[model samples]
Target: MANDKTSHEIGIDGAILATQVPGNNGTLILSIQQTSALNNWLLKWANYLQNEQTPRNEWLMTTILIKSKSLKIEHKIAGVSPQKIPDSQYQAQGQRVTWVLMAADIQTT
Candidate 1:
């Protein structure tokens, strides 16, 4: 179907649960299924921000996209700083973690 597109075409990065971008503040909390690949990806950005040396923490910026059959959303987070990650524990199936991060700028589209 040339004119038909499903949520499957959005190319989700991983098994996402939910996303929260609270108000005008540059804060984003993302909840997703816990996996080694996803853990590494999140930690990579957090570590980069931690190691970066710059004033106002403006050295880093990243974009997050959310898609579904009825809605399409995007958020641009800048100067992101790692906030929290779950501790190591033996969790059963469908265990999810909310990754907290703060940024200098949070743009929406």
Candidate 2:
């Protein structure tokens, strides 16, 4: 279903993970690599939910990877959905790593 593009769909460039380490001097540590288009898509979806006032149940979660084995991974994006992302789905491409982020339900309370 991801192959099909809609009018609201945003083209993805890449995504990365930023994690905080206890003794890292409060620095934001980033993973090495991320798949292109993932972050962009999530952001687009998030914005759509906000703009359209859609319910959280209408949103779908996803995790995507680059198709090529030879491609280089750059950086990670933070705060993607956990339900869509799993640890097993990632492979560290040498010095490159990946991050997880969330595009979750919008709540007002």
Candidate 3:
């Protein structure tokens, strides 16, 4: 896909650094306001990854599809799961802090 001809033609492979995981351990950074429902769900999600003893592979495994012609970072991310979610912290300016979730076994197509 790197057949250079014109600009803005870079494929998905070109965005990635290499076969290894990108810096920051492929963490998906997210944050939710205190009033948002996702704030609760995010806490539960992190708890599940930390406390759940038996991980149901069939149910927990997920696939994420993203589409964006603007930046050309669209791809189907499969086998997504909560790899690591440490303590939740908030900034002085905002009530909700950014949570980093590490996901592995990602494949783009």
Candidate 4:
């Protein structure tokens, strides 16, 4: 799913809520978290809100807990961390992180 929202809205509220829904097989809190994280990171890192890539289809969501406190900056600046959930178990594809979701695995929380 593609989302065009701020990181705070998606990450703090959206992701947290998504982490509480049940799926066809069972509850998929983990998937929700991962997806939320992916979306959140993209918003912050890729800066998709301003100038976005057209036909943005190829993207990935990774399950990443905050590695210590995250510092939200334009790019990589020194000694800056924001309030984030640390110690994430992010699953990565290549050098980037993404959350792979199954068809039946939908988040309700």
At residue 68, candidate 4 shows an lDDT of: 31
* Tens digits of lDDT, candidate 4, 4-106: 2223325644563223333222111222343465656744644442236633432323222223345532211222222223234546632332332222222
Best by TM-score: 1
- The clash count for each model shown is 0, 19, 0, 16
Model 1: lDDT of residue 82: 65
TM-score of each: 0.50, 0.23, 0.49, 0.17
Clashing pairs in 1: none
Q: Please rank every candidate by lDDT, starting with the best.
A: 1, 3, 2, 4
Q: What lDDT would candidate 4 get against the real structure?
A: 0.33
For model 1, how does the per-residue alpha-carbon lDDT over 23-84 read when each residue is reduced to its tens digit? 44456777776775787698766666566464443444555544454666666556566676
Rank the candidate models, highest TM-score first: 1, 3, 2, 4
- 35, model 2: CA deviation in Å? 19
Candidate 4 wrong stretches, greater than 4 Å: 1-21, 24-46, 58-60, 65-109
C-alpha root-mean-square deviation, each candidate: 15.2, 19.8, 9.5, 18.7
TM-score-superior candidate, 2 or 4? 2
What is candidate 3's lDDT per residue for 39-108, written digit by digit as tens? 6777676677556585666434655677787877766555556645435556665476556554443444
For candidate 1, give the lDDT: 0.58
| Candidates 1 and 2 compared by TM-score, better number | 1
